[model samples]
Target: MLFRNVISILLIFGTPSLVLGCGFPPDLWCSSPEISEKCGVEKQCSLWHSKQALTDVPLVRYELYYESLCPGCKQLILTQLYPAWLKVQSIVNVTLVPYGNAQENKYGGKWNFTCQHGPAECVGNLVETCILSILPFDKAFPFIHCLETYNPSTDGKYCASLYNLLSYWPSIEECSTGPNGNSLEHDMAVKTNALNPPHQYVPWVVLNGVHNEEIQSQAESDSLALICNAYQGVKPAGCTKTGFIRSPVKKIL
Candidate 1:
């Protein structure tokens, strides 16, 4: 299955609403206070995005569901996702869901998970997800890519101090190591299981809630081309220069 990093927002009178878009759901998302706190900032977040981020504006909601230590996942994220983000960050909202295709298991009062790369990958998954929960996308992403670039061969807390993410360790350490961490990962598993047409592997890619098939093969090579073609507004000079045909994405009815 494919995991989605969906967030929820709390209402004025305490009613809750499901929120799915880029950025932390909303401040004070009461459904899960501790989890929500990790995604919150000192200032309250607005349910409404800035004018540039409104629906009318052409936007590509890039959804990447991948394991933290998978080779293909790492390649696409560092080469495809990050670079494409730099080019079109003004017009896109990239959401990363690090759970990928793994399932969680429980036994003997302990929670466990398996990753394509082995036990170490599972540990890396928790660390990455924990980072995202606290840091904004821009900060969290660079840390992820940097660690991958510096030591793709090894994955885990080794680079936490290297990136100074350890400064936020107090905030995330609880979320990544205990039952709290288990619950957070559980949320990801739930979202992954809910994909309308479940995915077949890691690094599943989607744009505007639809699957992008061409990405499986060309992500590292031509992701910007895909996003540029899919964009539905005043074409940036970059997009026009390519004159690329719109690549259709598979929409779920």
Candidate 2:
């Protein structure tokens, strides 16, 4: 009788329908015959579909912490970062935190920021924060590139219009001018301040959550090489085109 009861309990608990929660090691939690029907059909976990299953390429994590209106930041974004992204975006997971060397204060439930440049920079940072929030990374990047290429302070709406993102402008403007912008910028500030080893200047480049002077110099000088070199396994065509990877010599057997 005890053996029968134990078998019954095992059968009940072992059924895939009884499983709860989905996570990594997707084969087990997502798509194994034991779990696939319930977990895969319901969860539709994008990570497995979009990234992991596609190529199994490990993407390099690159985070740039900078403030609007900083000359070095502008140059890096305009010349190095954006161009490199155009090439290696598929191989790099990029995050831009636009709050560098900024101080924040709260008064009466209202948050105010003091940026490194001035009031214009504060507004510019808020605008960028709103841009990033409103659009997907692919759509937001060009708009940001446009703003930095010309004038972040004045070219916001113009850039949106140029990108046919005019419909989103009203929302972006409202975000920049409202409490949402404050919250977003506050999140950025928190992330920036929490960086290990801390950031000492604008345009601080962090790779895989690590920061150092050598990374800083390399990222500033040749971001493409920096990212390509960091990535492992099945490099994208961009790496070869950019001369970062050489085709291995085949042994003539």
Candidate 3:
């Protein structure tokens, strides 16, 4: 009986089913990167290279905390922010921190808070960091898109997809199963639970390893343009201050 109980517990907690199958169409996977040479042309491909350059550099570094099963995280990446970054070819290295199952406790209890809807934002960070370490952004982008499509309501499906996507090539399954996997999630859970209390939220983006006034103020659109211009060495001309407000967390930092 004890052995059976242990097995049940392991099955319950060892792996959470957050990832489903790939959300993006198959054609996206086959598209060639060569097609997108310049910014504003085939923006997604350009951004992939830009992100690659940023991550490839030794000095520049940034961390993005996300929950793997969070829908808001998906909207933030696919609908709002990443597209812009792709257009500019922004060379910013990002770290992904996964906070699993933001909506419920390990015992399967629900907690109410600001962004507790899903785990996509926090987990997205983990996937990003894992991809950065192993595969280039070009190959990593599709894998990330696949992971983001996961629906937490289903359980483990998203995680399974993530496992499959990285199993080939550089193989990120090791990282997913390593200390960083749980560590990042634990850190994010502690921080978010403290901030909102009784509820867990994800997609906490920290720039330059500090979530201070400088990064927070600069994140604002009117303000972000200035920061972007300074960092990218370009004027903020024609850069509209719209669509950066997907999450209230971005406003904080």
TM-score of each: 0.65, 0.74, 0.42
The residue-by-residue lDDT of candidate 3 on 212-238, one tens digit each, is 545433343222343354354332233
Tens-digit per-residue lDDT, 178-239, candidate 2: 99999999999999999999887888889988899888877877788888889875566777
Q: Judged by TM-score, which candidate is best?
A: 2
Off by over 4 Å in 1: 1-55, 108-110, 151-164, 218-220, 236-253
- Sort the predicted structures by lDDT, highest score first: 2, 1, 3
lDDT of each: 0.62, 0.77, 0.44
Q: Native-vs-model 3 lDDT? A: 0.44
lDDT score at residue 35, model 2, on the 0-100 scale: 52
Which residue segments of model 2 deviate by more than 4 Å?
1-54, 243-253
Give the TM-score comparing model 1 with the true structure, all chains together: 0.65
Score candidate 1 by lDDT. Answer: 0.62
CA RMSD of all predictions: 16.0, 12.2, 21.1
Give per-residue lDDT, candidate 1, residue 135: 86
